[model samples]
Target chain A: MKSAFTRNRPLATAVTALVGLPLLLAGCGASSGSAGSENVTEISVMDYYNNEPDKSFIGDALNSCAAEAGVTLKRETVPGKSLISKVLQQSSSKTLPDVLMLDNPDLQQIAATGALAPLSDFKVSTEDFAPGVLSAGTYKDKVYGLAPTVNTIALFYNKDILAKAGVTPPATWDELEAAAAKLTEGDQYGLAFNANPTYEGTWQFLPLMWSNGGDEKNINTPETTQALQLWTDLVKDGSVSSSALNWTQADVNDQFLAGKAAMMVNGPWQIPALSKQPSLQYGVVKIPVREAGQTAVAPLGGEVWTVPQTGNKARQAKAAEIVSCLNSDKNQMSMAKARNTIPSKTSLAETFAKENPKLATFTELVKTARARTGQLGDGWPAQATKIYTAIQAALTGSASPGDALKQAQGQ
Target chain B: MSLAADLSPSKAQSRQHGPAVDQAPLVPRRRNRHRKERLFQWLFLVPAVVYMALFFGYPVVKNVIMSFQDYTTATFFTGEAPWVGVQNYVTVLSSSLFSTSLLNTALFTIGSILGQFVIGLALAIFFQRKFPLNGILRSLLLLPWLLPLIVSSAVWRWILDKDSGALNRFLGDLNIIETGVPWLTSTSLALIAVVGVNIWIGIPFNLTILYGGLQEIPDELYEAGSLDGATGWKAFRYITWPMLKPVVSVVLVLGVVYTLKVLDIILGLTNGGPANSTQTIATQSYALSFQEFKFGEGAALGNVLVIISLVFAVLYLRASRRAVDE
Candidate 1:
């Protein structure tokens, strides 16, 4: 056996060399790509509007804006959830699109990475934009992104169901609880809202938490506990189904459309789907506050367009031009009208609300809507995780609201 | 065929071809021909070895290195991961949720493997009997295995939904239960329900592999056992069990390894939620890396899982070796 192995030593050596050759080659290879050309005729744009109407609406707006700026557009739309992962991959490969759209809350996190150029770098004005929307796009006092339109969650109730139950639109937490209980019937709950273990859950809870004077920076306070207690009481009262722990915002909307839920807390994005059900008469109102006089403070929900640092001066300037033009007064109104969202600029709010009365509540809410990252900045992601974790723990009855908050914060 | 002949290739060749091809002047040519034959034999194995190295070995090594470094969202852009020297491991091991996750993983794997093996073995043995349409029925049993895990998870999610689930509806119709059972919503029951769904998904794979193993054991052993007053339980213990030990170990080890890293089913069903009753190490690792963006801690936890799998693999290999030797 020893003699045979000695005889095959040369063959073994050759095989070993062959196996190592590819690994060495793989290590030496560098993945790089050149930026869009200086004399750019067409600039690449990336956004998360892969769904139907928003896809076409954003496409038309981009085409019009590109024409206004004297350039053609190359568009790439990904699913809403995967937009951040795609941006990270593109950022690392130095292949970030010239123009990119980010969910408002994520803008601060991405901007902190220095992958986005400040709008002021290309002489784009941030003046007259809603304070909340501007705060969402700003990092360290520099505005890195701008939005044409924005949205926020609100109380959407079935008009037919409310009339049948002899219940009015709830204006306070007590009224909401009573109304939800009154509407509860066989196979149907009085209320539906997402409290799933995701950022969306945290987003939905912001209205209650902010209205009750809860702050994300210090989540385990009395105000936050009271907000969580409201959710727990609803679920405990059997007005909100135990399955709200698993439902997404879309799932909540489905429950409402099916008449399994008399009311749902959702955003204007559900309007198109709601319109598809012609017989379902739904009316929109602000999410209930903890008290009658308290203002309903919903978290702002929108996508902001920005120019990424693509290492090409001419293309960056042109990308900025398209970004600015997409947010111009005329384009903002048109895009907001096309999509079921409110204009981000305060100047355009009155006109947009007058034009699209269905979105008036959202428009009014947008004025007081707070950016999720307003306090935490880049730290918002961690806080959001804690918020959702606590919500899940409290709703599941595994921990009290206070204990859940403590556990969620890793104390 | 002899060891001496193999060591001395020229002697074997001369004996085979009548000593004519072993000429002294043509010795270099003969050596070149032998080397070419060995190279061709090696060429067949090179592709498989290269694939394993690239796909499996590289990732394992990369994960270990990442576990020791502070790999985060910034690392993807800056390409700078500061080495933290086991701090990630410390954090993972010391976290309060670690114990809960470790216990959950053990229960999930053991529960799934035990349920699948017992039911699968029973079906495999039952299918061994000759019957009409037996072949067709056995082939159809593999359909569950063929379906993607995510599809199974989604179907199970609807079936186990609290208010309007089919399971509750069926039970309610029979007056077996008044209200719906909170299968995925309650902390105490979610883990068991998840394990039950996983067992259903795993049954087909175990049954097919065990059935193949059973067929390899000749009928003569059973006949011999029956002659010696061994039948049914006695026959299986004295004959089938000993012969099927190797295959059983393989099934169990593979099942444990696969179960240890299950992510999608848990994510789709409970998302490691309802107060984290279903939070296993694999799902928690995913949450850390993707949800919390803490890749280093995720890698640390992943390495822990790999070590656990390696332990089971080593024990099974040793047991199999002893079984072969005996």
Candidate 2:
């Protein structure tokens, strides 16, 4: 050989480079593995449920049920800050957990994504589940998710702060704004809220939009603009701090518990957390209306259990079993007790109320509470992003509610 | 160090531009000798090449093809693509948000590059010579760069929080400021805050690279220049500046490419928010893909991102050559 060294040098280098590159890459890359259905007897249920340290909670009860049912359960509990993003990411990979818990309106979005597996395998209907709870998961005439636990918005007031300030809970936005101004003082913000578009901006503003006599689907209407304008006025009048947009729902609950703010628009989920706080002297009521013609609105919020249609019969069957367990009356009651949610079991409202007194007003509000305009389980993300972002933008002076909604809807 | 090489390549591809088929054989024993050499070369390269072709190259081509088809994951692996050619591209190009992302990316890149270069160069020159705790200081300068951008941006998010944040906390404590500024909540201030974070992150890399270049300049040159009536700023403008040109070009080109593709920082910091003020193309692409449930549109966004970065690379390379010519 005229020289093996000279002849193979370039070849060896190239080969080494080729082999080394793959080895290096293999050692350090995110693998998009095929989601195998083999041995998938168990279903993973992820919830936007916040974990409590208590010995008994909704998450723990669910785990106990899974243990009782002899099925594997992957329980994921996430904070409000990362919940939506985590759900979205999991959905994109077709690795959606078999069960999910979150606001009902989001289930509508997931259904629209074709991510929430249809409940066809289980063949459950709206009649099989609680009214309004099942509506968020029905798309194209197919039901997708089942709500095991549900909670909707309610106006929360610090009884101690308001009582001390000699103010009554306001029934209308104008009175609420007035109460806020009266209560606000040195280093004490009057009202606490979360104005995040995907979070409070959607949940809190939905009621405002409804109070102003605007429909969720028609979010860019003049009434919606006026509703947003009212909120903007609150910000300008110094009744509500502009910083609320960045506050998380959990964060607002903390501020309320700390007695930092006089009143806040919150939901039933805060009941268990707040009830234990020694400084928490709060009462729940209907979300305030802005006009006499309008009624207070509480945006529909809840969770759903689902089965993804990945075309694997065995996998689908296992997922369905998980969903069935989730929808069972026993599980629903368990979830309600642990999650501190409004029982989706219509029959248990009285029981839930007697056990948790803070939930009583929210229950009353639910009678008139506005279900999100995603009856077909569609159009909320597109609409809410427009409605809520506009409301926030107007409040922050990024746009007039009129212009913000107009811009958001691309009108 | 954490950022060094943590990406899993189990499916990563190794790419190569092979010699043409008409290449002359090695002298005489080039045939059998070549066979053995080729065997060894192929043996080593086979794994990486196969990995790349399977994972990266194949997926890229597949994704591009998928972009043209009206398809989802369900449709793609089913052995056929319903080719509705150019529909995805049409949807993206027609969308107004695409244009916004492009404009935002441009603004973000240009603004950050200027800040990184000027400030990085300053720090680099400042740290050029030996000093007390020189090694310690150089290592400490790498802290922001060394930490994951996720951790950095998360920390920055706390600092920029409108309430109970470090920035507002410090400012209020000094009594120099009366009210807490909404560093991120404001539409006008959101982008600026994210850019400020990006600049903070980008400075260390530039400083490290430029400092490395600064060290290469012999100390005698500066001493000789000082003797030749070149002192202080004058010495740097003459001997130091001309010599550092190659390294500066490298930093600019490298920095531009990397910053233009930045996704995590912008996402973690603002999410293109306060109404899309901080929205970059990558985050927008991510939003389109996951949030909006439009994978084709998302892929189109990635394509646009790739095209934009390619253009930046070409332009920077041209500028680098021009500098060399000058």
Candidate 3:
């Protein structure tokens, strides 16, 4: 046995060397191949519009933008949840796509990594963009990305159910609670909003938290607790289903569409699906504030286009042109109309709201919408996790709203 | 000439058919042939060794190295992960969630293994009897194992949904309760619900292995036990159990190891939610790395899990060895 072991040592070393050689060579090859010629033709783009109508709608927009930029398009669409991880992987491999689309909240984190080149470097104009949109795409005051269209959560009420219950569309917390209590009956929940243990839950809770004067930087304060209390009371009173603790925003939309929920807090992205039910008349309103006079501040939701540092200067420049074209007023208007989103430009949004009155509330909400990462920057995900954790704790009856927030903040 | 005489019949026949070798070099020729034979044996093992090193060894070593570094999202782009020694382990072990996750991992593994094994063994023994359509029934039992875990979890999610799930609807019809049971929603019940789904997924695997073990038990032992007034319960105790001990140890060890790293079912069903009632070390590690981009902490937790699995594996080796000795 000893002799046999000694005999195999050389073979083992040979195997290790053989296995490692390709990996080392491959790394060198990847780095060297990225610095290509100046006459770039097919610029690659990556985004997370992997699902339906939005996929085709965004595809057409990108193809047209590529045409305008005098380059053929090579586009890759991933599922929304996987986009960030994919970006990190590609960044490490030095194969990051020329044009990258990130969820606005994620722009700061990616920008912090220096993987994204600031759009200003390519002479892309940020003029006429909404403050919230600009803030979402900005890191350390340098604009790294831009969203052509943006969206925010709002109160989506089922018209027939609200009419049947004789409850008005709520505009304040008091009215909302009263209206929800009145509408809840038998098998139907009065309101549906996700409080799941995910970032989506934090996004849904932001309208209430921000409008109530809550700050993510210091969530243990009274204002955030009050917002959490509102969520807790609704679940406790059975106005909202206890199952909201597990429901995603998509699930809340489903509950509303099935008439199991009289109202839901969701984004306008649900409009296409809701429109399919022609008989189901639904109206959108800004998410209610704590009091009558306070403004409703919803968190901005959209995908921002940016140029990634792919080591090819010409391609990066061409990619920035496509991003600028996508955010052009004409393209923004067309994309917003097709995608049921609010245009990022303040003037275009006003004209868009005038043309499509159905999106007026969303347009109005966008004016005062806040970017989640505006205050926390790359640190936003940690705070977002804490917020959702607190929501789950309070809603699950494990702790009081204040205690849950305090405990989460302490973590 | 003497070496040729010592050769096996086949080798000697081949040598006779080939060109004749010089008598003076016979000893050296034999030693050269022996060395070539040894090299050929090692060459045959190359693929398996390379595969194990590349897949299992590389990832485990990489995770260990990452655990000592301040690896994060920035590290991906910058390629600079400063070594932090034991700081990651210290943080991960000291966190409030660590104890909860440890306790939850223990409960999840014990509950799943106990439920799956007992149920599996019973089904395996029951199927030992002669019954019509027995083969088809046993094959049907393997369906749960055949389905992808994600697919199974998705189906179970619908079945266990609070308001409109099939389980609630069925229970409602039977007047089990007035309201829907919040199977996947309640903090108190979410863990159990996740465990139940895991158990269902694991049953087929346990049953298939235990059933094969049971088939290997000689019927003659049972026949002799019956003569000694040991029929049903007595026969199983005296004949089947002692013989099935080795397989039982294997099944339990494998089940525990698999259950310790369960992520997908818990993720798909609840995402370690309802206030993290279902959060195990595996899911928490996943959240740390992918969700929070805290790769260092995630690798630390993952290493802790690997140590636990290694402990079980050691015990399994000892137990199997004891079985062999017996």
Candidate 4:
């Protein structure tokens, strides 16, 4: 946990991989003679990753890895949640793909249930991966997944809206409140925030909690209560709409594009969607602090590839190989560039900026991203929903935030 | 169940006539119904029964078990669920919200059924007159019912919007009232608005069914009444009412069952909101199960709703049988 706050020195290994990505990819092609009887085995991977251009960018890297390893790669696209459900369903029927992409697969409980195959068993080295990335996919100190990209949350704002309001993006809690209030007018809201009354409603809340030095599952504490208080204050002051309760991030995005909202706290996944609205000019900013003098610390969330235990050892081995190759620097770089995703390796952040300069601003913000506060466990799922929904009720004037926080903490 | 069956020829009769009817000795007894046939019967039923057992039955049973145990959908997805017995249900009951939600659901059901039945019966009677444009108007009447629930709910939500709602704007333009009422946003008014919308959607169904029932009543009886100097309201009450009784009873009971179980309408309408005042049992049950993953508590809620519907169904059947006998 502490290693996360510390650098942990991944710079040297990442730089090496970045320089070698192209050369290693080149060596993948035109193998013959002494290459032995091993032929390139092509496997398809399906994920909700990026649009066509970014998909092709990542596709190119996957192809390069296949060539280098005498293996071929094919890809399929699906929404992340749908893809994960498909994989889980396939486990019962033994109809799994060679490789899969999942977000917050939370394989620890799955691994504990003997679903995921341990990575150590496959002889894969984990030294190059980020601490949290590997740890999130591990169970009882055994790796179950290899994440190609690291996705984090950040504050997204309309540059035109801010400029017209004669305000810069707020750096601190008080400043955020003042700026948001100033930006508010009839039919134009200051902040488009998540008001979804669900456990997962913690997206905006978590960052606020962290900035206040609070953790999840302990929401009744002073720091957590302060975080909840921030939202309650906004709602009560009419800076935020009470009707935003139980809304998805897409709902917030819709409001922003319609020119009804000035600023909203969303995520990296929303960048492409925002970019698609050519008429709307916006930029990504680090989340504003809700604490006395702290910087915003938005939590990171992304997908990981994991192999599961099954009757067919041959298929399982092949799947493991596919996971390993897909995690290569070439594919990671392509994904980073194409999808605006931060690869688990810090080096790809530079590649992403070089490939797509527009995303450089967001890539820079990745340095200070924090993981969500709470153990990724089974107990947290429904409890989180109850807590968030109650928070919504509190914010919407049905209950007080203090009472809501108390209920959540009790749960 | 026994009354509803389409009875096949009796096996006992065939057995009794077997000695005299059978010609082939080598074929033996009951050639058409062999042990293999019995095995095949089990086999045919297996796939459908197994499918239900796994997907529906198991989940229902599991849900009941889970309501007793503190379970979450996310935790269930990860596959290691620790049991905390009856805590979730006790908590749900003790929360002070469930009782009010249950009352809301009952009120909604009663209000919706009464409005839909009365209005629908009126439409059915009007359409029975065979007017010049009856066919066109009958088809047009189904517009609300034809639209999907969620889509219509969203449209209604906009129309009920406090600021930009079309209904409010039109009412203001017409000066129907001094000011607009917060149709959906108001805690006290949301439930009434939802029930009103639901009744509107339900009218076509009642009209169609009652219209069909009106057809089955002979014109001869009405003609005889007219010849005997029986006039409009009196003749209609004595002659038309008796025939329509069966159909009205069915509609009333079915409406009770359906309206009681209404969730999507409530979910799409106000999402049981403004506060707990508009909340319903069906919505709470779904929210408890899928959204909260408290399957057990959800199941308990569901079971209560199911029992409510089942009681109405049984009552309808009993009344129908008594009506037939009388």
Clashing pairs in 3: none
**Comparison by TM-score, 3 against 4, better one:** 3
Clashes of each: 0, 12, 0, 11
Q: Local distance difference test, per candidate?
A: 0.88, 0.71, 0.90, 0.69
Model 3 scores a TM of 0.93
Least lDDT summed over 10 consecutive residues: which range in candidate 4 chain A? A31-40
lDDT of 3: 0.90
CAPRI quality band, candidate 1: acceptable
Looking at candidate 4, what TM-score does chain B attain? 0.84
User: Where is model 1 more than 4 Å wrong at Cα?
Assistant: A1-37, B1-50, B319-326
Tens digits of per-residue lDDT for model 3 on A1-411? 644564466467657766876885576565536557988889988999998889999999999999998999988999988999999988898889999999998999999988999999999999999999999999999999999999999999999999987889999999999999999998899999999998999999999999999999999999999999999999999999988988888889999999999999999999988999998999999888999999889899998999998878889899999999999999999999999999999988778999999899999989888999999998998899999999999999999999999999999
Residue A246 lDDT (model 1): 82
Q: What are the per-residue Cα lDDT tens digits for candidate 1 across A1-411?
A: 644564466457657768787887787564534444567788899999997878999999999989988889899999886888888888877788889999888888788777899989899989899899998999999999998999999999999999998999999999999999999999989999999887888999999999999999988899999999999999999999998888889889989999999999999989999999999999999999999999889899899999998888899999999999989999898888888989999988888889899999999999888999999987888799889889999999988998898788763
Off by over 4 Å in 3: A1-32, B1-25, B323-326
DockQ of each: 0.34, 0.21, 0.38, 0.11
Candidate that beats the other on lDDT, 1 or 2, i.e. the better one: 1
Q: How much is the lDDT of residue B80 in candidate 3? A: 91
What's the candidate order when arranged by decreasing lDDT?
Answer: 3, 1, 2, 4
Docking tier of model 3: it is acceptable
Segments of candidate 4 deviating more than 4 angstroms = A1-88, A128-132, A350-357, A373-376, B2-97, B143-150, B153-197, B220-242, B260-301, B319-326
lDDT of 1 at A20: 80
Best by DockQ: 3
